[model samples]
Target: MELVLRSYCDLRLLLLLLGFSAGAVLSRPTDEGKEVWGYVTVHKDAHMFWWLYYATNPWKNFSELPLIMWLQGGPGGSSTGFGNFEEIGPLDSNLKPRNTTWLQSASLLFVDNPVGTGFSYVNTSDAYTKNLDMVASDMMVLLKTFFDSHTEFQTIPFYIFSESYGGKMAAGISLELHKAIQQGSIKCNFAGVALGDSWISPIDSVLSWGPYLYSMSLLDDQGLAEVSKVAEQVLDAVSEGHYQKATQLWGKAEMVIEQNTDGVNFYNILTKSTPTPAKESSLEFTQSHLVQLCQRHVRHLQQDALSQLMNGPIRKKLKIIPEDHSWGGQATNVFQNMEGDFMKPVISIVDELLEAGVNVTVYNGQLDLIVDTMGQEAWVRKLKWPELSKFNQLKRKALYSDPQSSETSAFVKSYKNLAFFWILRAGHMA
Candidate 1:
């Protein structure tokens, strides 16, 4: 009887092994899959924000792919604005929807972020109140919720990427996430972060405008001499202080190109006389593209932003607000009222991230006068990282519109790790 029992047990063990093998063989492929749509709660103040999240599994053969979280910069912009519109949206080049390629390779996440941005909305009219720290904290909570729901991703490598003002947001959030990990509040296998054409440091970025002007051939030795001779001399003599001088200097710099370029569209080079269209206008989405963008990300942007867009002066008249101000009413001054000091704390945050073994790369388009490449270089020099010698390698590279699109601009300088590249023809949208 004992011998018969041992044989039965061995047979049961073999059957179990076969079942496990079959289960492994029949599992799903990693890449080119459908995105999982979901919402995470933001419990910040008296109000709550239901933030939107688009998540996809990692691509084929790679079961444990890195998870990338993308932030669309603007003190208020939607990740869908660019991430889906241009980079890795669940669509093909023709804008026909498809869950394939890059989306499958990595677990990509794009959040509406902050209470005021994207489809994430708050109940009270007071939901618009925001600041960098508030955003970082809200994101932290959202990430926790994400991990709880997709516990399988708890051990996957994580990365954050952003552009424009999001560079600042990404930096702050990365620092905060590192802190949370250290404190045991959250767990992550955090990787490096990247930003392009980000408006991070004002002093460092402002200088990029000069080179941009020169790139356009708007500033020749003769033109510089001409400006210094009379126009600049007069402005310098009469300026009340540095603030006024800066304003005047920027105006003069703008004027230098205003006469040289087509003069019809001064702000955006891509727009030919008409206002620049969104990248996805070709796809012809049913809902007004703008409305869909706001709905998908920001729950609060009412009809006012649309009205302001229609009215010219109203758009320009919008004021920059403090970093922590509310966005309750019309978003007339949302973008205009920028808190200039937002990037002030980024230096310390970067330092903290590096200390915590996080890799950070800040790149800029040389043609973007708004967030100048020159400024980024100066900022990096100022950081004085002890391992600065590693950043000495520099090589040229080509910047492209998409993985499939033709090359758009040539980039200068490719470094070992911590690096910046100047995209010759791109602007703030780079």
Candidate 2:
């Protein structure tokens, strides 16, 4: 594999050729593959880290494949760490080749966004973004710098794929990117965005929790009623413009859920629950509960092994990361800084993208408790896009990952620029 490491200090790109002797699977890259990682100063004292893996399609030229940029949720999640290793990069968390890696189809770019996520860092806490707008602005700066430096990718088809809060960022970024491309500020064939079990409409997801759980037989009528009561409080707090209070109530609702469902896993209901400590019930919600929950879901990303891998081996490999900056060290501050904006819905942003004829795809795992499929449908129904009605009327086509498999993998419905996929038996990570 050919790797290019970009230095943040001198802004120099150093190319390195490395050999790997891993066992090959079907369709894995056999010829030369290029990997590039670096930091772009997006704002004063704020640098965003991005890692790009060139498409491994030996049959075609590297520039011919589409580029898919991944954004992890948490408003602070390390896409380079979680999305790359855990989800769809070339390797798994164990450093083994991932069979389902997206590298076979498209080039992958994992970004540590919002200035304080993963390897991205801010010199001062004041530089952390307080809202998605700031996040989008920083992302725009990062993209501009990236395209300017790597002129070869300027005209390639580019797409953004995000999970949870990253979806919210992706929506805003896509709209802004579209506008920038139209204004001649950026040169690229920006294609579309895919929101995978995204926290686009927090209220919608919160409101649907009771019904979703009850339908799954995880909660009884009384349990549903209790969950509903707390959920309503969350909605009330959000409606009254008390966002911080709403965040708190959201936590209380989660506690109520834990009490009712015997500590069910919030990501995938079918998964075994890891019981929360009894003391956690009395914990204050000074921080956003959604952020806390996201942290828990992706906690392994910040734990010792992965932490050491990134901060030790990965950091040493990159060599551009500053000595003082630790991987995911500033993630908590990143979550805390965006608390007030946590509960706000980005549905209108989706509407704007749809109206602009940007391809907007929404996919939700049926088993996801946080950002459930019901909630996704609820919010999608509220879109003001003219083609939404037609989109809904269309029959969903079953999708199968394996041609020989009898079971359906997912179902999808699409019209014009909008599409929605219901992933089978998957969770928030889908």
Candidate 3:
């Protein structure tokens, strides 16, 4: 029987954001198998809930394998959604009969995080933006409880793997764990980290994204030239303290999507989709339906995009539109803004971990024009670690240039215990 561990986040909005409803493990395989869920009390008034899955004596053998903590970014994304759906779930090929849960070798933990994401809720806006340090502390509390409950993992090395905005949390949280272990406040056995298509540093990322896009022909030479001109103008405007102009310049270049036979509709754009299990619906589509087509393809984004952009529930507060041409300058500036405020704590924390001999990896997918590979590249270059030297791939260059994570160009660098990889053709989830 397969063992699956599930964790949840409780954004206790009413009870001062302190109470978390724990997750429970259901449908155990054997008579002796055990699955449990509940809260791990953190502070005197705070609790972090989690669920566990395991055979009652699965570890009666040996317990030295790694424990992996998986995170999916969005600052509000659910690991169970993407991580389970795309990466490593028990079901595959449209959730058809497949058992892919490799539970015996290592432990996998997935958490729904932040105050406003998933089933998690926070009472007010002020409490929600509580920052990365607070999140790290919460993770520490949860992990501590986990280790205490599973005595086998007390001294076993564990690693954190995350993608996208999660890189911010992974890097920051690892640093906090390092500090805790170092100061003798907590005893943690941490190994290394692996990040795929992450968003760690954006400024430098913007610069590197261009070359990758050009090489892959995601942007033609002519398009590259135009992008360069616009990028320079935008960068200069941003540097010279021209916020509005910079954003406008950036948007002009940002909206360009490759045209296709279908004319920018669902069939034309590259997005993740699985075959409908057992033929459920039928609909004929055409180019004229591009607007509705895209809306249908990305329903999740369409539903919450406005809510996130507006900052809260639709009924409670209506956001006053800024005089700017863009709607509060999303798609281009929101990540930058959030990185400055919500992401710095984690950045500093990751740096601290690096200083403590902990391995940190940061990577990005190349063809993702939305997240902008240039931004990720710029961020890495700024690291300026003398030991970090680029090793670009020679074989499969076309794959690297392609905008598919499965097929993309890549580069690698190593600095001390830290390793960084940049994927050629991926997106934010890369």
Ordering by TM-score: 2, 1, 3
TM-score of 2: 0.90
Which parts of model 1 are misplaced by more than 4 Å?
1-28, 44-62, 92-95, 98-101, 219-345, 393-417, 422-426
Question: Top lDDT: which candidate number?
Answer: 2
Instruction: Please estimate how well model 3 matches the true structure, expressed as its whole-model Cα lDDT.
Output: 0.46
Off by over 4 Å in 3: 1-36, 39-62, 92-99, 102-105, 229-253, 256-351, 363-378, 384-386, 389-415, 421-430
Q: Where is model 3 poorest over a 10-residue stretch in terms of lDDT? A: 9-18
> Which candidate do you rate higher for TM-score, 1 or 3?
1
Better of 2 and 3 by TM-score: 2
The lDDT for every candidate, in the order shown, is 0.50, 0.80, 0.46
Instruction: Tell me the TM-score of each prediction against the true structure.
Output: 0.64, 0.90, 0.60
lDDT preference between candidates 2 and 3, better one: 2
Q: On a 0 to 1 TM-score scale, where does candidate 1 land against the true structure?
A: 0.64
